[model samples]
Target: MTSESSPTIGLPAGDDVFPVLPLRDIVVFPHMIVPLFVGREKSIRALEEVMRADKQILLATQQNPSEDEPTPESIFTVGTLASVLQLLKLPDGTVKVLVEGVSRAEILRYTANENYYEAHARRIADNVGDQVEVEALARSVVAEFENYVKLNKKISPEVVGAVTQLDDYSKVADTVASHLAIKIPEKQAILALPTVVERLERVLGMMESEISVLQVEKRIRSRVKRQMEKTQREYYLNEQMKAIQKELGDSEDGKDELAELEEKINKTKLSKEAREKAQNELKKLRQMSPMSAEATVVRNYLDWLLGIPWGKKSKVRNDLNYAQEVLDADHFGLEKVKDRIVEYLAVQSRASKIRGPILCLVGPPGVGKTSLGKSIAKATGREFVRMSLGGVRDEAEIRGHRRTYIGSMPGKVIQSMRKAKKSNPLFLLDEIDKLGMDFRGDPSSALLEVLDPEQNQSFNDHYLEVDYDLSSVMFVTTANTLNIPPPLMDRMEIIRIAGYTEDEKSDTSRLYLVPNILMEHALEAKEFSVDDEALKTVIRRYTREAGVRNLERELATLARKSVKELILAKKKSIKVSPKNLEDFLG
Candidate 1:
């Protein structure tokens, strides 16, 4: 409807009374046309009253859109006077009305009406303050509104052409404000402004802010679109390359490698749990790119899994006499240790399936504790592997680090087993008492699972993520003192290796140390000789130790001096005696 026709039909002969319509979410500005869906009873009544009489309604925004029936205080004082152009009553008991805003109006008072809300209000004329300032703001707001329409695809471009053609600045400001996607309170504040310059300025500021936000949103959309396209392009190229390689028969190497691993997985005698885990990891490896880092980690895990001696075992020497002979030939005077080892061999010979005993040899430093482990391995004919637990503090050092960690691997236990190359090896854990605890974890606690006969049959490594059989492997631990943790101490049978007696040390020097020192010095037994009294004097005077380690050092020194004496004196033989022992030794 035209502006002149709407004002003439709304109020006749200075009557300010009009039907009041409370809008829920919109603030209607003058010169703006909008469609309203009237659902509330009072709203439908107000629309019907205006359609029947003057087709005029005072449209005010509700303070709270959630309010079903708004009181006078809930409605804004200033509103737009709108003329109803068309009204359609639907079967759902709602009226759809098309209304054209005519002018701004101020509510004077509410009139008593039984059917619907009626309000006495007067039209509010626009105040044009300083034509120059109003003209400047209108131009800036129009420019910004055009930019907003371009950035925001929701607004029609035709609206910008319609706004620029309007000669009245007040109408231009109201037209721009109506099209803006701003909140109700902000639009209401713009409608409440009396001066055209003030309304245009407020609209300009809001348009600029909206334009800035839209520009940022546009940039983000462009960036995300580019990233998605790049990812899709790379994926397509990789798939095409794979297809080309397959057609040319160039992908057979990778296929052959995977097939070989699959064959190994089938042939190698892995336990039930371990075989299942290997198959699952291999499936994942097949799906992943060969060049990817994650694929390498999975491949390394499979290598470790396949590298373990699953069913391979060395033949355990069953002869007790041979074991005793080997033990006696290696060590001098540890009769008790040798006897225990021979007993173990004897029992293993008779039993069908025997789990190796966990032996902890407690002794002083340099008392042949470490050497005894080697001797036992030799006598039993099992592969020997030694892992020192002197300063091991991380539990990972024993149980292995998880595969999630970078550069992670199986713990010392699993690593040693891999090196042993046999399922049943003599695994010696040296310095068991020196196992340390820290924040990473307690190595001693981790060893509990390794030493327990009941639990160690299915020893689990973190990186391997599979159970390994340790039932056949013999574990020997040596410590300087019995200062081991009680839990660890409980798992193994303790064998105390006491210091050697004076006589035992003398015999050990005469028999073991002297021969080894002569062989090392390149001197034969005929050329260099030490009498029993001279050896006793050297042991009693020069060295004072519980073990034969110091006596060995003293004997080595005498061998070196004997070599020097034979070279200078041109003598065929050099005899070290107690009479001239200080002359040679000092």
Candidate 2:
């Protein structure tokens, strides 16, 4: 409930407000100043609101503002009450505003009236002392912060003098830490630190540690910056590529470069099987626009054809040790499912570095299916993504809605592929059995080419119109039942996800679930105890499901019912008992 620290020289008159722009990775304290360029209509309007309102605003960050409409979510309980100090309108129709943060405020979410952002907030109450008295720590922190500034990339050391004159120590420390020219997640971690002291300590530690290994740090920074710049350049180039592709009209059926290649291969004296394979590749390529990323991927893919030793494989051992270790580390039980996956990997090791068969795990709800998929990804060192097909009936859901449809997409498969940013991923198609067919189209039938290994190597999604090699993708599907289409089911190796046995549930209760339940309720385990018999009774009498669905609900309910009584007993300086379960359960 304390206020955020500010950065401007003098305290903000106890009332002058500032607009807190809550970006994903930036955290500014009450006494900290954040500079933002306002160009987008939404951001411009934000600045206009502050300027029109005399620079008073709740500058809070949000995950998604547009979706919630008008109200951009206020991230943390603590945020700066910033005020507009200076405003400049640029010739390019952009506004530059310098806002002064006054105090910290606790925002209770947001409520919007118009197209801008608004929130209900109360001032944060930080009782930390001023910086002048803590000279040693301040000197050490500031000095370390100066070094942090120097070591970082894209940041000039000249900014240090201005930083030292910064009013709030915490704000200064966090600001330097924020703009440390570090990774987004690293910056986010610094911003998310609760106390200025903690932030200073954490940042100083990283700075001191990294500075000692200065060469390594510099090398890493240089490499990362180069990679990032390269990626941005490539992304822009790709956009331009798309525009050019659009300028070129459609390729007539069987008349593109790929089609001609197919004709040549067909006329050659190749075997029927070889001819068919090359023909499929050509057809897929012809369908793909040359300038598209998919076409680029396909073109590059043809290079492998000249080189792959036909059946050469890697040295992945069939031993169950690594897989077992990973599975046991992340999950409690489901040994059968784990064993099957390990076996699949073992069998796949014999193949020429191609994908293992797609696995669709079918089980009742809440049997840790999704988590298991993640663990498998971790085990195989592959990225993981989940695409739910529960209510999608359109063929476009599996393939993609054609771009001609106005708001077109490159299919869930393509999106997932993009998300992983890799050719190979442990793609989890969740709730496959739940996928339904309605007026749009049967999405499951469309998934046929995607899941079918025979055709998925050249999977031609409708929107992409390009045959993407889904063959490299180690796809996994999860279903609550075995009622999935036989064609779809046939393509996958099914792993039955059974409910946790009572003993397994007991282990989870003691190990993972109960501790989390206590932490969430903001209570210690010592506040209350459940007898082994009571736990058994709760599991058997109150809940009956193959999954831990009801078990989670019951634990939550038990914690809620006991919390008030536990608090009352604590106030009285006494103990509470298991008999208290009745009030909660009832």
Across 14-104, the per-residue lDDT of candidate 1 in tens digits comes to 3489999999999999878899999988888888787778768999999999999789999999899998988999999998999999988
Backbone clash pairs for candidate 1 read 400-411
Give candidate 2's whole-model lDDT.
0.66
User: Could you tell me how far off, in angstroms, the CA of residue 377 lies in candidate 2 after the best superposition?
Assistant: 0.8
How far residue 256's Cα lies from its native spot in candidate 1, in Å, is 4.8
Best by lDDT: 1
**Model 2 C-alpha lDDT per residue in residues 14-33, reported as the tens digit of each score:** 43233445544344556566
List lDDT for all candidates, in order.
Answer: 0.86, 0.66
Position 175, candidate 2: lDDT = 58
User: Residue 286 error for model 2, in Å?
Assistant: 24
Provide the global lDDT of candidate 1 against the true structure: 0.86
Instruction: Identify the runs in model 2 with alpha carbons over 4 angstroms from their true place.
Output: 1-319, 354-356, 566-578
